[model samples]
Target: MTRHLPARTCRDCGRNRPNHGRGLCRGCWLRQWRATNGRYDVATGTGMGGPGIPKTAADIAARLEDYAFLRALNVRRLDIAARLGVSYRTLNRYDARLRQQQDTA
Candidate 1:
């Protein structure tokens, strides 16, 4: 008899994306969402004052650096935002973005 692997689905969008993160579909997850505290500017992509668009390794690296550091310390979401001077919700969004960036790279 042959064994069969279970199929997985994307958490967001719900479009049956090969499992990646917790309940996050690649389509919806691939796109940047609001930052940790749930804030955004429809007119521009500047959430926390970096760039209008995602450019330069520094921008991405800066976000990733914060995420990795916080994760390593096992800091609470709220604490992380407070320490990093950002919204908790924004931190959540940033964490996701960092994960995606790492995955792609």
Candidate 2:
């Protein structure tokens, strides 16, 4: 005799589906992951800049200024990255480029 397990429902929205993780369905799991891992707009269900931040020099410069302002106040780089809605690596690259520019100036 084979025993069958009942399908799992999302722990959040309660829609019946296979469990994605943490007892959540796929959509709920995605939402939860995005909310915690990125600057996810709840209403739109997407990230701040869709895919990633723009790579234009002006954009980078503005981000660098923000990073510097936060740093002057003694904010941690990880916290600043979260507050700015960018990844730590991206912020690090921006900082590196800013430093190079300052060195050359």
- Cα lDDT tens digits for candidate 2, 37-104: 74423212224445653469777678789998998899987788777767666766777887898899
The TM-scores of all predictions, comma-separated, are 0.40, 0.49
Per-candidate local distance difference test: 0.59, 0.72
For candidate 2, give the lDDT. 0.72
> Which RMSD values do the candidates have, in order?
13.1, 6.8
Please give the lDDT score at residue 71 for candidate 2.
Answer: 88
Tens digit per residue, CA lDDT, model 1, 2-88: 544344665555566554455665455545444443443221233555554535878656866887788898977666665555555
